[model samples]
Every structure is written in structure tokens, then in C-alpha cells.
Target chain A: MGKIKILNPGLLSTIQDGGRFGYQQYGMPVAGAMDLHSLQLANWCVRNPAHEACIEATILGPTIEFQSDTYIAISGATIQPFVNEQAINMNAGIKVRAGDVLSFGSIQTGCRIYIAIAGGFDIPELMESKSTYLRGNLGGFEGRALKAGDELEIADYERRLKGVVPEELIPNYSNFTEIRITSGAEIKRFTMDGVKTFLCSVYSISPQSDRMGYRLSGQKIEHANGADIISSGIVTGAIQVPGHGEPIIMMSDHQTVGGYTKIAQVISVDLPLLGQMKPGDQIKFKEVNLDQAQQLLLERNQWLKQHGIE
Target chain B: MIEYIPSGDSAFLVKFGNEISEEINRKVRAYFIALSNKKLEGIIECVPSYTDLMVLYDPLKIQYKSLLKELKILAENISEIEIPEAKTVEIPVCYGGNFGEDMDAVIAHTGLREQEIIEKHSQNSYLVYMLGFTPGFCYLGGMDKSIATPRKEVPSQKILAGSVGLAAEQTGIYPIESPGGWQIIGRTPYRLFDPNRKPEFLLQAGDYLKFYPISEEEYYKLNEND
Candidate 1:
């Protein structure tokens, strides 16, 4: 068995996979990689399965010492990665020998970083996922963020596959992002002016935001009626505006149901871009119909398939 | 008539009504079970709530139009689908002491004695309209308004698991420790969430919940048993 000792766990680092499915009905939040596309690409670089667990390093990244020769890959946020004092290329496989020190520099762009190993994390699945639900305290590295002195075992893999991801596939996370969205179920509950304000107004991410949801600080969305809805079913990406009117975009770990008026849902293709947004970052919503939303998703899937990244 | 609204690219809500009602919830529960049993391709899961059921699907496998058509046809036979009987789960609570942080506040608001408040809270059975907000946390219906207490002005940052409380006209249990505003009055030792158990949650939507008074000593015993 291979091991990696955490020298310094920066910001918030946790192990994640595709997420726990088939359990939302039990009020379980599906805790998964915030930027699923990045997670998949990182796994592809290391030749791991699409759903294999990876370390999700937020804004800041971790410093670690490798304990065995293993092939690894780094993707997502633009954090400079180094192996034994030498800088390494991201979205590509690099071989690390025992006692090699792997560390990362301050993030230049985006808000999260994903690191994947060839064989995957030797973490047991809880509720069929290695993803950590910190609030629920379930799964992944004791269901919490990694800290200094933590040692984790890695799975074994004999051969390292070619891990060059196409240049075009690498995402360039920008300062300000335009998130595409489809009108939500409670759109009718919002006035025309309210809807327009939501589409046109620029919002900044609140520092309070996390895996559960991104609370946006912007123009208060005027409810056609009162904002309260009978607590109903909700999904990730659904933008709910509470009585206070600040739109909160549900993220990867959103609860199954909620009571606020949901005005829009960020499209699947743009969710990755939303995931990369950090506190104080600016975002504007662009409305797209359901057809356009699904079309974008199809194109993304097709692109991933063509590049052998799926 | 059932209304279908798009939740996102991959999901939609099958809404039975705009308000909360047992009849509407029954329909939501029935359709939730029916759609799951149908096992339609591309459909991921169905989450039943107070008045609507959210159907999550794969956008790549099936488009919204085709899924809507399929859902419309399924609605025709929805009434025929029998919703399973709600299990009457008994939850024991140790009331009005150290276990309840906001017990005094609740007593003051209701103008009722501690024992009287517990008797009123436990004497009635409540309907589990849904399980949400957090895992195993249920939205229970039919709390007596006389004993209803407004939520705390400032919500607590940390509420222990199994804390039973009243908020507005609703009385429910906090399945897991979470930040909440409920006027807590009691605590239960029963584990509501055990991933290793056959059912991860203690209750589901459509389940009946009944609370009974227990001594603080009994709470310790039950807690140790779990």
C-alpha cells in the first residue's frame, strides 16, 4: 500500500467522488465534487475511473510527502504544483517516488483544485461514495477536511497510462464569470422586474458560501407575492431567493428540499464555472430555455467523449 | 390536475397543489412510489415533498419534452397506485431539563406549565409530510396551535441531534445536530441517522410520528443502546 502524509492542509481539502446517489429521498444531501467536470478531467489524467475519489483542494492547496512511487495528476484551480522543489505540469501524469515532497503554491485563478492518483484513494465508501459531507459528518477522511500530520493510503496500479489532456480541454478560470441558467419552477412567483433584475444585475459571491450553496449579494429580487413557498423539492443549481431576497445558488451539497422561491437554475454546463467562483468574485446570470440548457449539456458530453476524457 | 415545472436541465417538479394538504401530499407520495416502481429509463430518483415530487433525470439520456410526455401518461394511472401505509414510529423524548436548551423560553411563550406543555406536545400524533432540510429531519404536521411557539429571534449555531422543538405552528425533531431556530423543549436518544442501518433515516415522508414522555435516565439508557 502507498501512503501520502499531509505536511500542511491548506484552506479546505477533502476527498470527493461523483457523490452519493439513490439516497436523496432520505433527506441526504448529495455531497460530491463541486466542479464535477474538473474532477473527471483530473481522474482522466491519472487514468483512474470517472468516479474514483480525488482530493479537492479549495482556494489554497495542500503540501504533502509521497510514500511510494505512484502516478498522479493535478487539475482544476491554477495552483502551481511542485514535486521535490521542481515545478510540474498540470493535467498530465507525473511519477513520484517514495519520500518525494509534493506541494502547491498560492492559487492564481479559480477557487478549487483537484488532485488524482492513478489507482485512486484507498478510502472506503460510505453510502456508496467517498465524498465527504462535513455537516452530516459522513464519509471521506473521517468526514472532514484534511489537516497536518494526516496519512492516507493509496490504491495500487501497475502501469501508468499516457495522461496528456488536450490543450483545449483545460479550462481557463477567469475573474468574472457569466453563468447560464434556465428559469426555475417558481419563476411565476417572481415579478417581471424581479426576473429582469436577476438576469441583469451583477452579484458578488459571499464569503459565507461553501459546498452547500453560494449566497449572492446583489439587488434584492422583488417577489410578485411573498417569497415563501411550501417547502418543496430542490436540486443543485436551483437559485432560491428567500424573503430577504438575496439569491442563493444551491451547490453540490444542497439539501433535497427547500421553502424559498427558486427563480432559476444554473445550467449543467455552467455549473463548473460557478463552482470555480471565489468570494468577492463577480457573476451575472444569462437566461436560457430548457432546450438550450440541455443542448449545452449534450455538447459538453460530446466534447468529453471526443477527447477521450469521459 | 398535476402541473410539471422544470427544476433544472436534469430535473422537474410534479406539483399537485400550491398549498399544504394531506390529500395533495398523498398524491405526491403515491406518484413518488409509482414513478420509482416504473423504472423509466434516464430517471434517476424521485423526491416527494409536501405538495410536489421532484423527478431527477439524465439530460443526456432523455430530453425534457420526452420525459414530460412520459410523466403525463404516468399521471393517468397515478390514482391507482396505492401508497403504502404510514408506519407509526414512537419517538421517546426526555423533556424540560438540561436536554432542552430553550425549554424555559417555550414555557414562557405558551403560558403553560412544563408538564402540561409536554402532555399537549406528546398526546397528539403528527404526520410526516416530508423528510428534508437535513437527513432524517422530518416536516411534521398537526401540532396544536395552543402550544405553538415562535422560533428564537437569534437561531442557535449548534443544536444537538434528536432535539425536539416547536417553531411557529410546526413541531418536529432535529434528526441531526444543525444550526436551527426552533424553540427546543426536549431531546430523544434514538439515532435517527445510521448509514450502516438497513434504512439510513429513522422516518420517511408518509410516516406517522408519535412522541411519548420518558425520564432523563431512560434517555441515557436508550442513548447507550444505540
Candidate 2:
């Protein structure tokens, strides 16, 4: 079996794929990579399936020692990925011999980086996924983040071929981003002033944000009624408003149900931008109709297919 | 009246009512069972909550408007949907000790004696509204308001699995160790969530859960037996 030995597990790294779906009814969250587009691109660089599990490294990355020759690609964050002490171009497949050391330097941009290896990470698949849900202690490597000296097994592949992800597809992880949103079920619950405040004001990402939610601190939007509502199913990117008037953007690891009133849902096409945002980043929401939001999603899928990445 | 709205690009929210009630819950379960039997193309899964159902689907295979139309038809005959009989599950709980770290806080807030609190808590059967917040965690309703308490000012960093807690007007069980703000009153020895098990979760939505008190020694005995 081919393997990679961890020498220095950077700030935080976990295994993720598409996500754990079809289990939200059982109180299970669909934990997966924050940025699905980047993960898919990384997998494409290795000629693997789109859902293959990869390593999601935070601002800092890990130092890994490969035990066998394989093809690998780095995407998302502009982490200066190096093999054997030399920098390598990201978004392009790179071949390495056994005993080669792979490491990363300072992050050039973005908060999370993805590394996809040939045949993907051969971790135990839970609920048909290898993504890690940290709170539940399920999936991924021992159901937790990677640590130094932990051995990870990669799927064994005989022939390693070079692949490329077009340069234009790479995203610029800007600190200030404009996120698009569609009105939510409870969109009418907010007063006109509240709606205006939400749309016009800039919100800074709170430090207490995580995979479960991104709490944004900005001008308090007054609601017509109280913020409490009947507990209902919450989708990813749902922007919930609690009684305190702060907005919380649900992410991939969001709970299956929540009682807070939701004002808007971030457009599916802009979720990758939200995923790459770090604490203290600024975000301004732009309102779009449901048709426009759905159209954007369709366009994204079509683009991915056109590039042969999905 | 039932209304289906787009939750996002890939899912739709099927809302049954504006408030939480057994009648609404039954409708959610009925429709969930009925929809699951449909095996609709592109329909991934349906999650039943207190007053709504989240129908996740693959937009590539089925359009949201088309799925909404199908759901509207299904909602028309929801009451006629045949749901399985609700199962009564008995859980043994050990009250007030190291296991229930926040037991004192609960007693202080309720002004009821420890035994009275336990009796009131264990008397009525709780309806499992849904399993959410964490794996195998059940959001139980029908707790007697006499002993109801608010969540802690600050959430604990870690609460043990199987710990039974009460917050606001609800009682719940933590399936895994995680951060929470509930006032714990007891612990059940039975495992609520086990990934190795066939169903993974011990209790599902629409199940009735009854609690019985046990001695601390008996709690350990049950754990040892498992």
C-alpha cells in the first residue's frame, strides 16, 4: 500500500470529499470541504473522480513525506507548495519519487488550501464519504484533524499522468468580497429598515466562526417581530438572524434544524467565496431573485462540465 | 395548509404549519414516509423537523419547480399516508451526581426538590420531535414546564454523551461529547449513537421515549453489561 507520512501538521488539516448526505434527518450534518469547486479542481488534476477525498489545510499547511511515487496537485489557497525544497506550479499535476518531501510556505491568499493525490486518500468511508465532521467525531482520519507523525494511506496507482486545470478557473481570494443572496422564507419578517440595513451595510466575519456557522457583526437589523421562529430545516448558506440581531451564515457543517429566523440564503454559486473567507474578512451581500440565483448555479455547473472538471 | 418554497438551489422547504404541535409532526412523518416510498428521480432525501420538511435533491436531475409540483400533489393525500406505528422506548437515567454536573443549577432554578424534579421529568413520555444538532441527538418535546430552565450563560466546553439535559421548554440527550449550554439532570447508560450499529441512531423521529430512574450503581452495571 502506498502511504504519506506526516511530519508537520500545520494549523489545521482534515480529509474531505463532496459531503455526507441523506443523513441530516438523523441529526447528522453534511460535513465536507469548505470549497467544493477547489476540491473538484484538485481531484481533476490527479485524474480522479470529483468526489475523491483530499486534504483541506488551513492558512498554514503540513509537511508530508511520500512513501511512493504519485501524482499530486495543490489548489485553492495560494500556498507555495514545494517538492524536495523547490516550488511547483499549482493547478498542474506534479510527479514525485518515493522519499520526496512535500511542504508549503506562507499562504499567499485564501484561508483554506486543498491537496489531491492520485487515486485520492484511501481513508475509511463513512456514510459513503470520507469528509470529517469534527463535532461528531466521525469520518476522515480517525474522525479528527491530522497531527504530526500520523500515517495516511493513499490509493495505490501504477501509472501517474500529468494533468492541468486551466489557469482562468483559479479564484482570487480577496479579503473583501461581494456575496449574492436570495430572499429566504422569513425574508418578510424583517422591517423595511432592517432589510435596507442588511443589504447596504458591510459585515465583518466574527472570530467565533467555524464550519457550523459564520457569525457576522454589523449594524443590527430590526425585525418586525421577535427573532424566534418555529424550528425548521436549514440549508447550507442560510443566513439566520438570532434575537441579538446578528446574522449567522450557515456553512457545510450547519445543523439540520434551527429555530432562528432566516432572512436570506447565500447564492449557491458564491458559496465557494464564502468558504474561502477567513475571520475579520469583510462581506457585502447583494440581493438577487430566485431565478437569478438558480441561473448562476446552472451556469457554474455547465462551466465545470465544459472544462471536464465535474 | 402546506406550502413548498425553495430552500436553496438544490433543496425545497415543505412547511406544514407556523407552530410546533403533535398534529404537525404527524403530518411531517406521514409525508416523509409517503415521499420516501415514491423513489422520485433526483430526490435525494427528506428531513422531517418540528414543523417543516427539507427535501434535498440533485438540481441537475430534477428542477426545483418540477419537484415542487410533485410535492404539492403528495401533500394533498398526506393524511392518508400510512406511517409505521410509533415505538415506545424505555431509557434508564441516573440522576444527580457526577454524571449530572448541572443538577444543582436545575434545582436552584426550578425551586423543586431533587426527587420531585426527577419524578416530573420521568413521568410524561417525551415525543422525539427530531434528531438534530448532533448525531443521534434527539430534540424531545412535552417536558413539564414546572422544571423548565434556561440554558447556561456560557456553554460548557464538553458534555459527555448520553447526558440528559433540559433547556427552555425542551429536554434532550447528547449523543456525542460536544459543547452545549443545557442544564443536565441525569444520564442514560444506553448509547444513543453508535456508528458501528446497523441503524447508527437508537431513536428516530416520531418515536416515544419514556424515562425511568435508576441508582448510580445500576447505571454503571448497565454500562459494564454493554
Q: State in Å the error of residue A239, model 1.
A: 1.2
- Residue A180 lDDT, candidate 2, scale 0-100: 94
- TM-score: model 1, chain A: 0.99
What does candidate 2's lDDT look like per residue over A8-53, in tens digits? 9899899989899888899889989999989988888888888789
Question: Which stretches of model 1 miss by more than 4 angstroms?
Answer: B97-107, B153-158, B224-226
RMSD of each: 1.9, 2.4
TM-scores of chain B, in order: 0.92, 0.92
lDDT of 1 by residue, A1-310 (tens): 8999999999899999999988888899998999998899889988899878999999988998999989999989888899988999998989999999989888999999999988998988898899999888888999899999999999998798858889898888987899999898889999999999998999999999999999999999999999998888899999999999899999988998888999999999998888899999999889889899999889989999998877
For model 2 chain A, the run of ten residues with the poorest summed lDDT: A157-166
TM-score, first chain, each model? 0.99, 0.98
What is the C-alpha lDDT profile of model 1 across B21-47, one tens digit per residue? Answer: 888888888788788888899998888
True-vs-predicted CA distance for residue A12, candidate 2, Å: 1.3
Which residue pairs overlap in candidate 2's backbone?
none
The residue ranges of model 2 lying beyond 4 angstroms of the native Cα positions read B96-118, B147-158, B179-183, B215-218, B224-226
